[model samples]
Target: VAGDEDLPVNIDDLDADFDPKEYDRRMQQIFNDDYYQKGAEEDDVPEVSDEELQ
Candidate 1:
């Protein structure tokens, strides 16, 4: 669509320096932080025992 049509011309404009590792590391860090924070807050809630229902 945009300029990415099959109109190849020069190799200099090509972005062959793409890195997926950096992107993965950032996503993992954000996920870990959110998971730990939620766990800490939920620990205060009461839990029902197996025998409580009887």
Candidate 2:
């Protein structure tokens, strides 16, 4: 499944320092619907003593 006639290219290769802010915003908007907010809330809670990792 490897063909070069219509190859996908790296975005970074096209523009060495490209920052597509709108593309980023759209992705964040999609991902922010659930898990992102939940993660933020979880980060705010304190960890219990016995649950601490080695």
Question: Which number leads on TM-score?
Answer: 1
Give residue 20's error in model 1 in angstroms.
1.2
TM-score of 1: 0.33
Angstrom error of the Cα, residue 51, model 2: value is 24
RMSD of each: 13.5, 10.6
Which window of ten consecutive residues has the lowest lDDT sum in model 2? Answer: 1-10
- Tens-digit lDDT string for candidate 2 (1-54): 134332324465356655688557545654554646655775896767865763
Q: After superposing candidate 2, which stretches have Cα over 4 Å from the reference?
A: 1-19, 33-54
C-alpha lDDT (0 to 100) for residue 8 of candidate 2 = 28
Please provide, for model 1 over 1-54, each residue's C-alpha lDDT reduced to its tens digit, 9 standing for 90 to 100: 145343332443344454588556544754566556766886886879989968
* TM-score, one value per model: 0.33, 0.26
Give per-residue lDDT, candidate 2, residue 27: 55
For candidate 2, what is the TM-score? 0.26
Clash counts for all predictions: 0, 0
The per-residue C-alpha lDDT of model 2 at residue 6 equals 29
